[model samples]
Target: MLIAQITDLHVSFDPAFLDGRVAPLEAVLRAVAVLAALDPRPDAVLLTGDLAENGSAEEYAFIRHALGELDLPVFAVPGNHDSSPAMRTGLGSFMRASEASHACYVVDDFPLSLVGLDTSVAGKAHGALDPARLEWLEKVLGQRAGRPVFMFMHHPPFDTGIRTMDACGLLEGRERLAELIAWHGGVVGVVCGHVHRSIHTSVAGVPTVVAPSCAHQIALELRANAPLQYRLEPPAIALHRCEQGQMMVSHVRYIPDFPGPWRF
Candidate 1:
């Protein structure tokens, strides 16, 4: 099965300047077109939060209509920029009824079990998984014992080299998550977004990845005090392919036009 991962949409109701003077909605539309044109379309799309520029109902409504054009089932988790209540109301049809309170749910229709976790803090730029949420996740994982599980959340549990971004990453409860992964033999990997750059790392010996933003990208700097900024780097999407007896494979496909492939 193949899944398309799109993140950090930052969609706004009004046109606003982003990287290279491009509007956020334009970037999202372009990315959606690319997803629509994939040769072998993905079975489902995973949206790893930041679905809105501001946690407003209008923004959520705009994004809901835009996503509806894809005509594919979308699974989502709330990011720092998302409002859990707004998402539940605006995108209610796509969300699981059982997860109405929070954005966490187990997608049951897919071949592999997908557990979406909510990591957004109420009024903070950073993320956190409270004891209640952590306990809930433990119960969910236990129920689906031995099934290949793909965990999705908004904030990456580990820090990337980007210092400013790292400061705003998941602040607590990661150690608990690592413990869960250490014993849960069925967890294939963890997929998340927030850093705005595609990053690969490991947590508790489990493969972890952060998808790139479809709108603008965070500047790549590794110094101790690098300025927080965005750049017009080629936006991209992550394609995760899972087979019967093989490890999940991830590919980063840049969204730019190139020369024709003349039977390479």
Candidate 2:
């Protein structure tokens, strides 16, 4: 099974895109097009978070229409900039079936099970999962025991060494989450999207990936007290392919047209 991952779109309704030359919505559309043109289409698309710049109704609507171009199944969760209510209302039928209160859900139609955890905190940049949400995850994992689960969330559970982004990383309940993942041998990996750069690490012996944004990316700074900044780095997406015996392979693909496919 193959899963295509896109994250941190930051789509906006601003005509000039916050008075800048690049329009984020256009980048999102390009990403969708790239996904659509893949050699072997992915079984599903995982939209990690930060779908909108301001989490406004109009922004959600724009995202809804833009993502609609891809007919494949799309699973999503809210990011720091997303409004829970607005996403619930705007995404509507696009979201997988789940309890109404939280956006956490499961997509089991494919070979690999997808479990999305809502890490977005309303009006806050950091992420946290209260007891109730953790309980929900435990219950889901228990019920789906022995299945290869790909857990998706907006905030990464580990620090990226980028001081500014790590400052707003998953705050509370991270240790509990790590424990849950450690206990669940079936969890193939934990996928996230807040840092806006492709990063890889292991959490509880399971692979944890932070996919790059389809829009701009956070500057890569590995220093204490580094300034918070963004750069117009090449946009990217992640593709995960499940191999024999449940070994998952991931590739970071940049969405740029380069001269290629020429014979050696």
Candidate 3:
């Protein structure tokens, strides 16, 4: 099975642009155009989070319009910037719900089982795995034992060492999240966003990925005390291909918003 991933669109409706600085909706449009042109296409599109800059109703409506042009299933979760009620309404009947009545959900029955976790702590940039979310995950995994699942979320459970971003990464009780991964041998990988930079690491023997945003990215800083460094990097997305024997391979791909040629 093949899956396409886009994250951190941070779109704003009405084309007003957020804070008179970033054009989040334009980025979203560029990513959509690229995805729609993929050759083999994909079974679904996974949006990790930060769908809007302020989680406004209009923003969600804009998201709905953009995604309606796709031919595959679209799934998403609430980021720090997403409002659950608005997301549900705008997304309509396609937003897959987990066993919980919320946005977190699991799509089983494929070689690529998708486990979407909600780590958005309302009104805060930081994230946490609350008790309710933990219990729901435990139950879902317990029942789906032996099924390889690819978990996705807005807040990465691990850190990238980019001080400011790490401060917004999954906070306390991450060890518990690790334990869940450790116990679930069927877990193939954990995919996340919100860092706006592409990176990867292993969590409990599973490959975890941090997908870059569809807009500007954070500068590649490896320091432990770095501040926010927004760079005009190529907007990118991730593609995960599930191979034989339950193995999953992923690649970080960037599609230029416009036609260009590079001579090497």
Cα displacement (Å) at residue 75, model 2: 0.6
Kindly list the per-residue Cα lDDT of model 2 for residues 90-196, writing each as its tens digit. 98766776676678888888777889999877788999987888998999888888888888899999999999998899997899998898777788878899999
True-vs-predicted CA distance for residue 261, candidate 1, Å: 24
Every model's Cα RMSD, please? 4.6, 4.4, 3.5
* lDDT of all predictions: 0.82, 0.85, 0.80
lDDT of 1 by residue, 1-264 (tens): 898998998887665444225467777887888999997989988889998878788877877787778888888888998888888788766566554345678887887888888998888989988887888889888888878888889999998989998899999899998888777777777899999898998887777999998877888889998789777677888999887766577888877742221211
The list of candidate 2 runs beyond 4 A from truth reads 16-19, 257-264
Better of 1 and 3 by TM-score: 1
Off by over 4 Å in 3: 14-21, 98-102, 258-264
Q: Which scores better on lDDT, 1 or 2?
A: 2
* Order of candidate numbers by lDDT, starting with the best: 2, 1, 3
lDDT of 3 by residue, 103-219 (tens): 678887576678888888878898888878888888888888887788889998887888898888889557888898788778877889998888888888788888998876787
What lDDT would candidate 2 get against the real structure? 0.85
Q: Could you tell me how far off, in angstroms, the CA of residue 152 lies in candidate 3 after the best superposition?
A: 0.5
Q: By the TM-score metric, which is better: model 2 or model 3?
A: 2
- Worst lDDT window (10 residues) for model 2? 255-264
Output the lDDT of residue 68, model 3. 74
Reference-based TM-score of each model: 0.92, 0.93, 0.91
Candidate 2 or 1, higher TM-score: 2
Give the Å shift of residue 201 in candidate 2.
Answer: 0.2
